[model samples]
Target: MSLFSTPFDPARDTALVTGAGNGIGRAIAQALVGEGVRTVFADISAERVSAAIGASKRPELAVPWVGDLAELDACDALLATADAALGGITHFVHSASPPRREADHALAVDRRIWQQMHAVNLDAGFHLARELAKRLIAAKRPGSFLFLTSLHAGTPRNLPHYSTAKAAMAMLVKELAKTFGRHDIRVNALVPGAIAAGGVRRGSRAGAAHSARASRRGQ
Candidate 1:
């Protein structure tokens, strides 16, 4: 009846968010829960994950899943958990990233930092997106996926590791978009500007933006 009205319901949909124990991931998961969507909080911190699960208003709607998303196998486990807990997921939010601070810029950056950055951000996102895409394809289901990217997805910051990963992540978004568009799956990155309050502020921004966008899409 309306341009924004969905024939299907979004509140009834399930959403999976990686790194949802704290910061951006936590915020995004909370937002999805606030929208009445079944939200799965996946993170490496069992304590924080449990806390988030306990803090939810609809505790039944917010399921906690703890694991290292950088490991591709974790995605399968998470999917299984979500499948059992919420039936199936129709949305995914990639909110995982390696530790970052102004102090970790190029002059002080080491190879380990670089590798960890790629492992957590770039590789995890690719693996999650790819695995979820395969599931959607095999099930003949359509879904939406959003990546918590930075403005660096276009312009580079002094953090070469973070910037390069974000840049590659942008390309990953495009690649997925091209491949999945025909299947009615939507893939896009949320590019946030410099939020000075650190990852907390960034997380809040991401949650707010994703909630607004999801509301607009009725998802």
Candidate 2:
């Protein structure tokens, strides 16, 4: 009998990535599929989901799931769909967040917008990670989970909704990592700078805010 021997074998890994319709999420899904991992790409738009899967290096290895993860039901549906499609999830990535507009600042941001941001970024991240960890523990398998947080987690970004949600996510990462470590499930946050992608556009006020923060740090 032959055995597979490798630190991380892409061929045996199955991943589910949210907000994979564009930008950083899209890039991560593509990279996973390109490495032979069966990746399930979940996004809010059917069109964008299709486009992301189409653009993947290995379309066959990429599965498309479109849903609004901000809703609890939608988040549950996504997990069910991934389980049905992939049998078992080995890698989980929560990168989906509502578009953060510059004009949507602290005083101007609507209450609903604040709730939506936390629902998607913080609520969904916690639910998804917990559910995935449950399955991995049940199957006695080791897995890795990554949440797409931001540098704004520690620094105020002027956008209360976005910044606060990210800050909460950062704490969630630490808590999950500590609790799930015994189960061999690793949880972490991928804090990214201002990238001119889907939601974080160039020349936007949010970008300017990030730049200002970076400058202050440098000083």
Candidate 3:
């Protein structure tokens, strides 16, 4: 199959991807642009957003947005900007997440940290997806939504805030899919295993071990 092959039609698909500043989110956003799909690369850092778009195969097809999704206002602002830029987004990818720190484990994590994690992962995700779905339903357009969840959603990551938030997101995906399916809006989740990217610190022991296990499984 061709690298850019997808069910999406380039002429029809316009996408909005959160956390496009780095890691899997950046890769997904860039790939959509490469397939000739106009895409919004939304990130918390302006520098990262600019850099991600600059690195895209078709930079002209990339629109940059910088915002903290932890706030409801920012979520509303993003939907407005994306609609203005794309004339209505047909694809939505929720990959935005607060960086996870090893120190933010169950006991060590503060209320502020826990709240921010849920605010971005669960609250912002639901708000953005539902709002987008509403627009698509009103327009009578078929759309697709993808959420970047984690294998740790079910397993303990020792990071209660991250794991718990993801677990809720897994359920959110089911709830959204069931509700939006009749509207022809598909909702799904991508539960990725340990990768040495994004929030994963380079050369961390946990990363190395996971990589080793993944390689063994492949072999």
Off by over 4 Å in 3: 1-4, 201-219
TM-score of 2: 0.88
Q: Over the stretch 76-179, how does candidate 1's per-residue lDDT look in tens digits?
A: 78878988988777898998876675566789878987887788788888877777778788888889999888888778677898899988888889999999
Compare the candidates by lDDT and give the number of the best one: 3
| Model 1, runs deviating above 4 Å | 1-12, 196-219
**Model 3: lDDT to the true structure:** 0.90
Between candidates 2 and 3, name the one with more favorable lDDT: 3
User: TM-score per candidate, in order?
Assistant: 0.79, 0.88, 0.90
Full-model lDDT for every candidate:
0.78, 0.88, 0.90
Q: Output the worst ten-in-a-row residue range by lDDT, candidate 2.
A: 1-10
Q: Over the stretch 1-219, how does candidate 3's per-residue lDDT look in tens digits?
A: 346545568778899999999888999998889888999999999999999999898999999999999999999999999999999999999999998877777889899989999999999999999999999999999999999999999999999999999999999999999999999999999999866454743247886677566657752
Positional deviation of residue 188's Cα in model 1 after best superposition, in angstroms: 1.1
> Which residue pairs collide in model 1, if any?
none
Better of 1 and 3 by TM-score: 3
Two-way lDDT contest, 1 vs 3, winner: 3
Q: What clash pairs does model 2 have?
A: none
lDDT score of model 1? 0.78
